[model samples]
Target: MKKSTKMMFFTMMIIGTMITMSSNSWMSMWMGLEVNMMSFIPLIYKMKNNKSAESSMIYFLTQSMSSMLMLFSISMNSMMENKMMILLTISLMIKMGAAPFQMWFTEMMNKMSWMNCLILMTWQKMAPMFICQMSQEKFLMSSALSTMVGAIGGLNQTSTRKIMAFSSINHMGWMMMCTTFNNNLWIMYLLIYSTLMMPLAWMFNEKMIMHSSQMMTNMKSMTEKMNITCMMMSMGGMPPMLGFLPKWMAINSMMESNMYMIMIMMIMMSIITLFYYMRITMSTMMIYEVQKKWMMINQNKNMYTSIMLTMNLLLMTMMMFF
Candidate 1:
């Protein structure tokens, strides 16, 4: 796509998300979702990649069906009806790519470029999750199940993108749990999650990486390896890392709310997610390299990589006072 055209679609996409988030009615939210989808599909395509085009189609169809369901539920004469609420919740879960409703999400992510993948993983989630509402039981069930599914789904996968897709699902579960307590908590979780993801995604995109094996053989610099390792560990929500802070806060909130059952489930699945994260970084840690910098792509190491990595640790430090 041309620069101007891309910019236009991107702006519209942002506006669409804002519309949905700010809308006071379900009908308006549904309209915003449609606008967002229309704009995003264009951005997901490349000049000649038929796979990307196919991915866009899948994304469109899935989102369209979900939106249709959402509209139908909203059009019901009484919004308070139990059946309408259930249908609305299901549609939102489908749109958010929560567990048992995320097959399209995984398929779409596999064929997308890194930038598109980042948008799908982070930005695209905002509108649906922003408006998500349901009973505590539904929230708890979605949270526990998504966390477990995400953790198990990534274990046997070698594709880096697929792993990240699963990781997003895992974090989606956490954010869902966050909703059970307070909206601000999930917003905090989302911000922290996005912070950890950006640099890792950048590194992968720059290196043209698609598998864990690439991290071992492709990233030759020690700095590269260290950065990637720490980021992955943090992403896994391990202690003393930035990612752990949000999960920690979430668990604390759940504890205060007496949500012990789902809390334990999330913690166990988190450990499973950490295992795959370890698998990805273990080889890099084992290998010794003498290169003095991060990847030297375009003949210059992007200073922002380390800057973002440091930002993570700095955030982790805030956990000490809490």
Candidate 2:
């Protein structure tokens, strides 16, 4: 019964995002966000972590406030076009956990399970981010700020989920920047980001790894460690890996558009972001720790893991042409 109920909410949550994505009007989009919030609040609860209850509450209040602001802006559209657009953009920014409005997001992520954190980082942002993309000028300042905050904020983090949360904010910065070039770039960015996140989240969930320290201690399998470390590098936009492709395209687009100041700032911030990713790998890379019996005993490659890792390489190839 518990599992079935969770699945039901999960399906509804996906449907809610679809509704907003497909909506032709502002009011309908707001309605979809409401549906999304209603469904998501239930899914945040976990048997082991009572912190999820508080996380869900904060998430609810934050999302509801955004929704109210959006609906008001939508309703008053005829009377105030410029002001309403600003209002609506702010609402969406709040919804997507972009910085300056991101306090609740990291807290919630810290409390939630890896699966819930994955959904919060990826799927839940799609609708609000899609709406925010429509307003390019307003999006720029927020995008820049997010990049800066995400880079600096992640530096001291030990919690793996919190690190990923900040990473999501950083990528949100990049994806928002992509919108200025056009819509397709951000969509491509989201798809690629989602692909890279799955295996990392699964690894954390499987090993119950929470902190940066645990990446070395808890993950006993070399294959698991190697795959995760490489994925982290790819995510940080190391060249030749899949994650770098979108950043590469975004930078090229910015250059073509003559966005020199913002481009320099974003590039600097990205290097900072990559540094923490490297820091996370140092534990697994530098150490010659005692091998556990399980490390040598287990040689079976998981079919799902093999497929995901293979897709990582394949995607790098396909996305370049795409």
Candidate 3:
């Protein structure tokens, strides 16, 4: 965990993702993915912790299996068999941790540092997802299953990281759907997803919050509570929020394609996800006190936190004028 070592791995991550994004050949793409996987495993290891070690090992096994399958599928592409293409799609799905292939994802999140979790949730997905996009295979069934599984899986979880992991899986479904239809929409969804997630991740890291209950107990001021509530609500894709914009566009696209059933299912599952966010928000609101002692004691006024929260909360309103 030396500073130099971290930088080296970080550089590898950037290079790997760039290579995958730019590569025209499947072999080069697979090489970039291997580089990404190898670089990330070291970053997952925390000092003197068996859990991180175990998590990293599991991650390596899963990713390596998927990489091999990808290579095999590529090798067999000349046969023009449907089964080979299906295997390729499944390999990318596993690499991206889409649901049904998502068993490793939450466990890995639980053991990783918040920084590593951020990278896992966001940057690590880029290469495989881009591969998925390019494959152009029909995976609507997988997309629906991912969204449904993500929604139901998080409903009973108290752990914040696990919930976010499920949320990521759910978003992956939407991303897959968009990628299947329009590349531009997929990119827009990703940008917005990352934008909403950054503030939430930063807040959790700053407060060391690991559960929904912690938010209710740890926040001291009305402002902190409100900010947290607003942020979570927006992230849940409530109407008039920045997060809703992408979903709105997605629904419109789905409708145009006559995908009514899939559209309905996605909307319903999203409502279930929002219900949990509201539950957490309500818990915090009900416990908030107006007493002087509760007035902004040791408020986190970190510049980055303030800026991200402000942008997340107000960006939708700003967009209204244009």
Residue lDDT tens for model 3, 91-165: 999998997999999898887777788889888888888888888786798889989988899899998898889
TM-score, per-candidate, Cα-based = 0.93, 0.94, 0.94
Error of 1 at 302 (Å): 6.5
Least lDDT summed over 10 consecutive residues: which range in candidate 2?
A: 295-304
Regions more than 4 Å wrong, model 1: 77-80, 133-137, 290-305
The global Cα lDDT (0 to 1) of model 1 is: 0.85
Model 1: colliding residue pairs: none
Q: 1-322, model 2: which lDDT tens digit per residue?
A: 2889988998999999899889888878888888899999888874446697899889999998988898888888899789888888888889999988989899999999899899999999888877876555457898999999999999999998899999999999999888877558889889989988887788789789899887787666666667777888988988878888889889988999899999999989989999999999977776644475655545434744685569666766677676
The C-alpha local distance difference test score for the whole of candidate 3 amounts to 0.84
**Model 3 lDDT, residue 99, Cα:** 75
- Ranked candidates, highest TM-score first: 2, 3, 1
Per-candidate clashes come to 0, 0, 0
Q: How big is the RMSD of model 1? A: 2.6
The superposed Cα distance between candidate 1 and the true structure at residue 16, in angstroms, equals 0.3
Taken over the whole model, the C-alpha lDDT of each candidate is 0.85, 0.85, 0.84
